[model samples]
Target: MVSRSRTRPITGVLVSLTAAGLLAGCVPGTSGAGSSNSAGKDTVVTDPAAMGKVTLNVLDTFSGGTDNAWMTSVVNAFEKKYPNITINRTSMAWGDAMAALPLKLKSHNPPDIVPPNNGWQSMGTLVRGGLLLNLDNYADAYGWKKSFPQSILSEHQFSTDGKQMGTGSVFGTPVARASLIEVYYNRSLLKQIGAKVPTTYAEFDSALAKAKSAGITPITLGNADQNGVTQPLFSLTDAFGAQSKISDFIYSKGDTGIAQTGFPKAVSTFKQWSDKGYLTKDYAGLASADAAQSFVNGKGLFHFDYSGSLPLKAGQSKGFGSFVLPRDDGGKPVTTASAAANLSISSKTKHADAAAAFLNFAAGEQAAELAVEHGTMPLLHANVKATGGDPLFADDVAIAQSISTNGTAVPFLDWATPTLYQTINTTMQSMLAGKSTEKAVVTAAGKDATAYAKTLGN
Candidate 1:
C-alpha cells in the first residue's frame, strides 16, 4: 500500500484497473492496408486474415492492482471493438521498464507497445536502431493531425539529424496529462503553526522559515527516486524563465538560451533550501514511498510531488490542500507536462491496422472518460468534473489549462530534450549528495547542453 504524509494532507490514492468484459465493434474504414507508396503514404491492409487474432504485447509501468484494473478496462474496450485482437499486458516499475526495454527489444518476445515518459530520449536509441516504425505516413493518412494539438503531437516525433528531436514522425500515444510539481501542504500543520498558503517565492520562503521556527519541518523530500528532487528543480527553473533556454539548446540548438541564467539559479536555490533546513535532514536518502508516509503521519509541513498523488493523499489523510509552487518575480505558475505513460506500436507487428485502431480509440474521447473515472487526467479535451480526490488536483488542472491556453506552459523538459533528463537527474542526485558542488553540476550540465546544441547543428 502507498503511504502519504499527513502533516499537510492532500487527497486520494492511486487506483489501477485489470481486464474485464468486451464492448462493441469497430467503425468502418479505420483499418490499415498492407502496402504503401514510395513516400510511405497510404496504409492499406490487403489481408484481413493477417490482422486476425493479433495479440499485442503491451508494457506498462504500473504495478498496482488498481492500475491493472483500469488498464484492463481500457484493453477490454479496445478488444471488444476489434474482437480479433488481444493485448497481453505486462506491468513493471518505472526503473525496471527503463532498464529492461532495451534488453527486451533484443529478445524475440519484445512487446509491441511500450510506455516511456522521457519521450525521444528514451525512444531515440530505438528509432535510430530502426526498430520503430515511422508513424508520420500513417498519421497523415489517418488524419491524426487534426485530432490533437501540434505541441502534443510533437512529443512523439524525433529528429535523426538532431535539428529537431520531436519533429517528422510519431512514435507514441499519450495516455494522461500531469503537471510538473504541485506543492502539497498539511493543513493541520499549517494551522498548528499559524502559517498561510504562499503565493510568491518570497512568501513561500517566509512560510518555510515560519514552519521551521515552529519546530515543524518545512518540506519532506524523497530523493531516493531522484525524480522527486529534479522535478521540483525543473519547476523552479521554469518559473525563473530558464526552461525555454535549456529546451531550445537541448532540442533545437537555439543560441539565446537560459542555461547561463535560469538553470544555475534553480540548482542554487535547491541547495539554499537544503542549507536553510527547509528540506528534511535525510532527504537525499528518502524514498518516495516513505516520504509520503512521513507526511501522512504529520512529520512535515509540505511536499513536492506530481498531481497524480492526489488519490494517495486522500487515502493517507483527511485534510490536504495543494498549491502551485510559487513563482519568483510575481510570475504566474508555469507548469511542465509530459505524456503520462504513452502507448506505442511496434513496426514489426503483423496487425498494424488493429494496433492503429487500438491507439486511435485510446487517444479519443471515450478513453478520456475512462481515464477520469480511474483517477487520471485525460489528455483529450473532456467535460468531466473533478471528483475532488485532492483539492490540489483541481488546482493543478486549472493551472495547467490556464498555462496551456495562454501558451505559457510547455511540455516537460525531459520530453523535449534527448537523453538530457537522465543527465539532469544524475546531476541533482550528485548535488544532493554533496559529492558535487552546485557550480560544478551546472557547469557540467551546461557543457552537456552545449554539446547537445552542437549535435542539433547550432
Candidate 2:
C-alpha cells in the first residue's frame, strides 16, 4: 500500500477509471451549500438520482499492488452505486504527486479530488493559496466528528489562514486505510539468532546485538533516496523520548521542543547501530523497496517500515510478524501515524457534491471490505477478517486499533516545515555515513523548523 510518510516512495502501476453513463437531476450550489446547520455550505447530496450527470477528475497515489487494487475496487463500486457520476482517475507515484500537485492545483483546470500529503508542505500550502476546498461542513453533515479518531482527523485540520495545524476547520479526510510505523521481523531470523520479539527498548537493543553477534544482519536499511532511514529513527525516538515532546517539535508547539527530549539520544543510538555493523551493508546505495524485498526474501532479521509496506504474499506471511516500537519503560505503545494518505478536495472543481460523495463512499462498508480484502487496514472501526489471508494484516489491524484506543499517535517530524523533509534526509544520511554527529542532526532539524516557524510569525 502507499505509505503516508515522506520516506517511503509511493510506486505502482498506473490505473485508470473510466465509465460512460448519465442521469439528470439537480445541480449543487457553490462551495458550501445544502446543509442545515452548515451555514448553507457543504452540499450533502447523497442521492444518486439527485446528483445529476457529473464527472470528477481524481488524482491519487495508490499505485502499487494492494493499494492499486483497493482503489480500483472502490472506484468501481462507487460508479456502480451512482451511475450518474463518472470517475476519471489518475494514479501516480508518491514522489511524483509531491512534485506535480502544487503546479497542477494552480492550473486553469485542476483535478476535482487530490490526495494531498498532510502537513504545511502540501495541504497547508494549498489551503493558503486557496487551491483546496474547506470540508468542515461536510464533516458536520456526515458525522465525521464521531466516525474518526481525533489524532487521525487533526492531520486534516488547518486554520483558515493555513498558518496553523492540528486545529481549526476540517479541510479533508484520511484515505480509507489506517497505518503506523513499526518493526517487522522474520520469525526464522529471530529463532536463528536466539532472539524473541522485543517488548521493550532494552530487549530490542539486546536482540540487535544478538543478531550481530551471530553474524546476521540485524536491520535491513535502504537510504539511497533518503526515505529508508526515517522510519526507524523516528521509532527509536518514540521509544527513548516522550511522545509529547516529539509531537510538540513536529508541530512547532513550543520553544525548542527537541532540546530536552530523547531525540539526540535516538540519533546517537541510530549511529551506534550503523557503527556496530548491525544494519545492511552498503545500505545507502539501496532503495527502501529493495531493502523490504530483501527482508521478505530472508536476508535480514528485521525491517523497519510502515505496517502496510510488508509486501508479503497472500497466505504466506506465517514466517513474519510485527510489533509496535516498545517504550523503554514498558509504557503504553506510542508512535507517529496519521492517514496513509490524507485526501483533499480541489477548490477549482465544479462538482463539490460529487467529490464529497466519493470521499464519503470511500469510508463506507463496501470500501472497508475492499481495503481488508487487499491487505490494508480500513479506517472504520469495524472488525475485519484476515487480509488476503495474510496474518500480518491481522497484526496491522491490531496495532492500529491498539494505538487508537490506548496508545499515543503523533504526526511525522518532517511535517515541521516545507523543507524539513530534505533537511532531515540529507542530515540523517550524513550521520549514517559517519560524516555528521547526533548533535549536528538535531541542530539542523531544529534550525529548519525554527526558520519555518519564524516565517509563520510563530
Candidate 3:
C-alpha cells in the first residue's frame, strides 16, 4: 500500500477465461483416476525436496517499504530452509500488479506464484478461468486453518465455479501484512484544539467540530487520483452498518444492496464534513501520499488511511497515533480490512508442490516474526510477539487484533463489481464537489452490483 506514484489505474476489465484460453489443462494434483493424491483428494506433499532443484517464478506487489523487506526475508528464509528451491521474485506497484496479473495469468507461462487483488476482476476471473490452483489441500497440510484466523482466511475463498466468493475453496494465502483502514491522528493537533482522542462516533464528531472551530484542518484527505477517500468513507460505512450486511453487498451475496448497508449514510457524512470545512480545501487535487505526509508534518487533526500507508516508521513521527474508528455505541471497533493482496499459485505451474510449500512457509512463525520486525502486521497474529520498541507498530498490531477478535471487519466495497471501482470513485468525487447526490451513488452501486450478479447467476 505504499504509494507508487507512477502506477496505472485499475481498469477492472474482466476477460473471459475460456475465450482467452487461460485454462491450458487440468491443474496438477487436481485430476486423475484412482490415485490417493490425485483428483484433488490428497495433495499433501511429504517431501517437496523430492522435486529437486525447482524454481518458483513469483509476482508480487510488495515493491517498497517494510513490506518489501518482509518479502525478501521470507524468500531468503524459505530458500535456506529448503536449499533446493530458488525463488525468482518480481515485485511491482499495486496498480501495476493489478493491471498486469490478469494478462499474465492468460499467458502460456504465468508465474508459478501470483499476487491476485481481491474481488471480481483478478481473483474471481482467474479462479473462474482455472488459472489459479485451489489451496485448500495445502491449507490442510500446513495446519493453516488452525493457525490463521477464519476472518482473514475467508477472504481468499471462492466457489469452484467462481460465481460465489467469501466461501468455498481457499485460493491463496496472505504473504506479509494485514491491512486495516483506520484513523491516524496528530496528537499535538488534537491537544492544541482542546479535544481528546475519540473512542466513539460522537466523540470523534465533537473532535472534528472542535478542530474546525479552532481553525485547524480536522481531516487531511487526498482524492486527486481517487485512492484516498476509500479508507474514511468505508470506515464510516463499517461504523454505521453491520459487517454481514456490508459483506453481503460486497460479495454479491443474497439481495442486499449498498443502500441497505450504511454506504449512503457514510457518503452523506463525508459530504457534510466537506461542507463544514473539516477536510482539506484542496483535497480534490492532492495526492494521498502528500496528504499523509502533511498530517505527519502536523497539519491536520486526523488522517484516515490503510495501515500500510503510514508515511513514517513506528516512532519516527512524534505526537502521532492511530486508532480504529469507533462505533456509535462505544462498542468494539470495526473497519474495512483484509490481508494485503494474497499470493496464489498458478494451476499451470509444473512446480505446484514447491510453490505450495513456499506459501506455507510464508504463513509460518518465522515469516510472521520477520513481518513484525519490518513493521507489517503478521498473518499469524496470535503467535507473533508484539513489536519490541515501536509503540506505533504495537498499536497497529493491537488494532488489528481488536478488530479480528472483538469487532467486525468488512471487505472493501470496490470488490462488489469489476466496474464498481470507477463507479464509486467518480461518484464520490462528484459528491464531494457538490455535483452528485449520495442517493445517486448508492443507487448506481446497487444497480452495478445487481447487473454483475446476474452475469454470475447469483
TM-score of each: 0.78, 0.86, 0.90
The TM-score between candidate 2 and the true structure equals 0.86
- Model 1, 138-238: lDDT tens digits are 57656777666555666667654324555666766666443345677888888887768888888888888899999899988787765477657776776
Error of 3 at 11 (Å): 0.8
User: Each candidate: RMSD to true structure?
Assistant: 8.9, 6.8, 3.9
lDDT of 2 by residue, 350-396 (tens): 78888888888886668767777776776655455455455666777
* Order of candidate numbers by lDDT, starting with the best: 3, 2, 1
- In model 1, the Cα lDDT at residue 347 comes to 52
**What is the Å distance of residue 396 in model 3 from its true position?**
1.1
Q: Model 2's lDDT to the true fold?
A: 0.74
Q: Flag the better candidate by lDDT, 2 or 3.
A: 3
**Candidates 1 and 2, the one with greater TM-score:** 2
Model 2 residue pairs with clashes: 12-63, 12-64, 32-41, 32-42, 33-41, 33-42
Candidate 3 residue-wise lDDT, 1-458, digit = tens: 24322112456334333345433322333331112112143645747678799889999887876668778988998898889899999999776676677568657798999988777766776776666787778888887776666667777888876678888788888664677677888877888878777988999999999888888999998888788888788888888877788888887777888888888889889889998888998899999888988888788889888775767754564467788888766767776777766888877678888888888877667877787777676554554766576656677777766654643677777887778877888888887788878888888878889888887779
Better of 1 and 3 by lDDT: 3
